[model samples]
Target: MNAPANQIPLQSATVGSDDEIDLFELIAVVWNGRRVLLGLMVTAVTLAAIYVGLTPKLYNASADIYPVNTIQLALISPGFSADAENRATGELSPELLFNTALMKLHSENMAEQFLSTTGAQVNPQGANPQTAKQFLDALSVSKEKSGTRAAINLHGTQPQETATQLKAYLNFVSQAVIVSVSRDLLAALDASIQYIDRSMEQARQQAENKRLDKAAVLAEAADIAAALSIQEPRIDHLAHTEVTPFNDKLYLLGTRALQAELAALQSRKQKDAFIPELRQLEAAKSALLMDAEKVRQHQTSIDAFTLPASILAPTQPAAPKTALILIAAVVIGLIAGLVTVFVRQGIRAYKIRTQSAYMAGYKKEILRREGHYAVL
Candidate 1:
């Protein structure tokens, strides 16, 4: 092995020569199958082009809704205060209102409502359950990561129509919130009004009962004065006979005054005037009624939340990306072309190797037979 230093250089040269020859053979294989490779590539590109062309185009439209700004908050604050007495109606804070609208935007009930209302024109098949479900699925409502805003997105064949529908859906959600809150507010006001009415009625009844009791006391005193034959004030014996309060002894006013007071009390018609709390109760009731009226009058104008920006229809189609599809086609075509070339070359090489081995075996057998015949 140590005597082969010169042969090592020769062996290395032979290895280099074999590697060069293999590289050239590979190049030859590719060159000879150029037609097949080119055909496959062209076919792949053509099919991709056809598929891209036939696909329908779609456009996306999105609208953003943010929490109510201070201006809108100020506008609706007075209305919310009207229901302060009944917390069961819930507070309509800006965050709660915004969340409510966002919830309604994604709710199935809203989908059905839109389908029956504005969606009818877009989808004339009417709001069957299936249709409503499909419409709901088409809608996308997502809150931004910052949590300050939410977005509603939709895609369709017509950009303008899609944008219009999205805007209408937003309006529908806003209106739904307004209607729900207004209804609760009105109900609370109505309950307050009823409660005030009951209180006023109770006050009037108590006042009337007190008036009747006073009249009875006056009647008894007048009878006692008439029996004693006293027609005028009798302060002469008041201090001497264990003097009590005047109210405890109405007879001291004499029969004439007592009779007059009794007649007046029996003839009183406006008992409410005697009820001290009646005026305050009436004022409160009037205030509640006014609030309810104001709510009704301005319910339609109330904006629960604000739109931060306008929803614009995208001018470009979102689907059927032309450049991307063409580039993908080229890449796929190139890959298919190379694969086809290698596969064909490999099959041809395998066939040639098989034939060469068979031919060598047959020639060896013929030589053996000729040698056998010569020996014979």
Candidate 2:
């Protein structure tokens, strides 16, 4: 059956009244637990303040670095130039050099090396895994949006100390880059020198072999001349003619001349003078040796990178933010207190409903027994 319109409106009004009463009860419960809420908030704020006081303050120091110019690149790598062809070799590009520095800065090996060499109070044995990780965690290298510069940031307890350490670390990385380049240059020069030496040696061997062959040919010719009893000059006109030196007619030279030429060739000790290309190889080897020396000498004078700005130490601590921590603590405490109040109210309501239901059931059983007695 359909209910009347007035009846439906009355039922809706009754439901709205119950909801309003419940809302008031909830408010009352929260107000009665105000002391508990205040106590919780105070405890949380106190703890947060204590933590702020106990934690050590950390300051940040940062510096910017950019790629060195072409002149500096030349200083680092001998024969390097600003030409596109040279840059195409990959080893001579300024961008590649700067990226290499960035890679080293982010490497764990570099962190360990810095810890071990700088005497930063690491383990006595050396830079252990934990120490190296901590050092890396405290340091950061980030490139700028323009991609032309990179920033190095470090955290430490003291501002001055942090700035000084950052500067020292930069210097160390620069020296390492320079040394690596110098070592590579020397290795290349040494390789070239070795190649030249091998070529010279091979040329000398070939020349000596040719000399032996020539001597054999001369001895055979001398024997032939002696059998023929020729004194000299069967080929006296052959030298003036366009005939090749190895022509068979040259064998007609007199026995005395052939024997004298063979003896002179056999007595020669040095074959390098006969190798036409050996002098050019010697010159190249000497040039390589000189370049290696120049690289060594320039190692101390060259700069591997350039700093765009000085390292600036921060005056304020980067961590242990007191105000933000305290505000967060207050917010958490209020939330916890509200939750606790609602939970307590819910438990009380459940217990009261349970007791009322149990008492009503007991009374119903008594009434049933009394009615049974009357019926009997």
Candidate 3:
């Protein structure tokens, strides 16, 4: 027959109670694997420590500023009929502060300008684009936030470089961006609008000239009417002294002619009204005057941002990042330990199951004492 029906495998863990683990056994397992565990731990920790040690010490540089409101509120209401938004509405908002940070990282114009302003010319030593990217990569930004404090960080390998970049960012961009558009600048802009005012005055004058011209033409029409009236009376006198007293037809005709002449003179004023050219000119003048005034009003001066923002120096220097390193190490170690225990315990469990099957006859020994038949 087979070597024994119950003959089973060994070389695995979990052979029932024999393989059940206690604290000492766990310690023993860990100790047994110590060489391997120690090797791995040492390798990992050493590599980590080495990497961290080799990394260059970073120094953070940063600056802060805010937009400010310079315009008086009274001037805002009548013009745009909207409340002028303040630049620095109370303290500097986190958003505007980040705006400054964005300029540092993303604003190509600002970045290029900063480089130029700082005299950072391309390296003449034949450094390629990759080298330049690498150098720039050395720069990093971090946001520091608290309940009532916030700051942006500019980190670099070199302390002076950090300071220089921070200073440049503060001077070139922050001050201008943070402050509300200055009143002086607004005034200058308004002065430019005065040119539009001058145009309006000229337009008004043109309208006045058109009015005067119309009046003068009407006055000439009045003179013609007066002359016609005077001639009509003379014509009536001629009718009254007709050559033949019996020539009633000529007298009647002269009377009608006098009436016709007076009527024609009175109608001259009405003709001036119907003159198409003069009517068009008057309409044009009125349109131009209305348009010119609108242009002047639109060209009026306005302030840009309402409230201004201002930032003082940082409340404190950048925090130490050593805590991050420590946390990282602990996390890495924990993962390693957990994985090691699972692998070792699983193997031990499998061996115990195999050995318990191999020791199947031990169950028969107990069953026989109870007078129970047991299969081999």
| TM-score, cand. 2 vs. native | 0.71
- Model 2 superposed RMSD (Cα): 6.8
- Compose the digit string of candidate 2's lDDT tens values, residues 1-376: 8887777444655666644556777779989999888888888898999999988887888898988888766654544211211221125557776877888887888777887787664322223433777767788899987878888888877787778778877887877877876787677667666767777878888898899888888887778778888767655555566533365655566778888889999999776788788887777667566667777877878556786356777899888888899999999889888998888877998899899999999999999999999999
Q: Evaluate all candidate structures by whole-model CA lDDT and list the values in order.
A: 0.75, 0.75, 0.46
- Candidate 3: stretches off by over 4 Å: 1-15, 32-36, 69-105, 120-150, 175-204, 218-376
Residue-level error in angstroms, candidate 1, position 152: 1.6
Worst 10 residues of 2 by lDDT: 81-90
* Each model's total of backbone clashes: 0, 0, 26
Better of 1 and 3 by lDDT: 1
lDDT of 1 by residue, 1-376 (tens): 4666566443555556743547778788889888877887788778888988887677788877788765565433444332223323234577878887888887888788777776455731122333666667667888988768887788776787778777777887888898887788788778878878888988888998888888888888888889888898777856565522236576877889989888989999888888888987887778777777876877788666786346787899877888898788878887887888888887887899899999999999999999999999
C-alpha lDDT of residue 211 in model 1: 85
